[model samples]
Target: AQSVAQPEDQVNVAEGNPLTVKCTYSVSGNPYLFWYVQYPNRGLQFLLKYITGDNLVKGSYGFEAEFNKSQTSFHLKKPSALVSDSALYFCAVSQRGTNAGKSTFGDGTTLTVKP
Candidate 1:
């Protein structure tokens, strides 16, 4: 079974400061990782993913993530955070080419960016 973890339940950041939402995974085989963001009353929106090549993967809305095989981590990052960036973030993982669209998701991390 594949499992993902977001160590922090809540992340508080200042507007314009660098922000990071940590994620780590455990899988039997090579993992396909994904990050998602959700706003109030809204469904999750894909943020980024790590499948093959380039450890640094960029995604929508100035967000990026680094896949560290050695650490088994795929933490989400943004150089500068905006107040609008405040949202719930999720980290997910699944065995490559096995689960298809199915994945194990983290409990979620609430990001709050204050002015």
Candidate 2:
């Protein structure tokens, strides 16, 4: 079965410091990995994706992720955390089954950035 795991319920960091939100997945064949950020009452915005090639992928708002195929991990990282960056983050895997539209989301991780 295809699945994802996000062990942290929340991650706290100071503004201007580097931050990371961890994620891990399990899938048959090659999987499409993604990271999304959700603001309060707002739909998730796509941060990045691992489709093919290059382990390192960059995305909107200075966010980036490294797809570790060997470890089955795709962790989101930012060089500097912003107070505005504090929000709910979800790591997802695309399931190309009949539910291709389905993106299995991790139980979101709330990021709190202290000013």
Candidate 3:
């Protein structure tokens, strides 16, 4: 089974500060990892993904994540955060080439960027 974990229910960061959102995964085979952000009452928006290349993958809105196969982790990062960056973030995982349309999502982590 493929699954994702976001240990923290919420993350608080100040504007202009860097932020990190932790994530971990479990899969039977090579994993397709993804990060998505959700605004209030809205659907998820794709942030970034780690499929093949460099373990360090950059994504939308100045966000990035490192795919660590040995650790089974894909932790999201941002060099600097904005108040607008506050949102619900999710870490998702699916087996490579296995109809990723049905990827499993972690319990979302709410990011609060205080101005």
Between which residue pairs do clashes occur in model 1?
none
> What TM-score fits each model?
0.97, 0.94, 0.96
Top candidate on lDDT is: 3
Per-residue C-alpha lDDT of model 2 across residues 4-54, encoded as one tens digit per residue: 999899999999999999999988878899999999999999899998999
Which prediction has more favorable lDDT, 1 or 2?
1
Tell me the deviation in Å of residue 32 in model 3.
Answer: 0.3
Best by TM-score: 1
lDDT (Cα atoms) of all candidates against the true structure: 0.94, 0.92, 0.95
Report the lDDT tens digits of candidate 3 across residue range 1-115. 7789999999999999999999999999889999999999999999999989899999999999999999999999999999999999999999877885779999999999999
Better model by TM-score: candidate 1 vs candidate 3: 1
Candidate 1 vs candidate 3, lDDT winner = 3
What overall lDDT, based on C-alpha atoms, would model 3 receive against the true structure? 0.95
Candidate order by lDDT, highest to lowest? 3, 1, 2
lDDT of 2 at 80: 99
- How big is the positional error of residue 95 in model 1, measured in Å on the Cα after superposition? 0.3
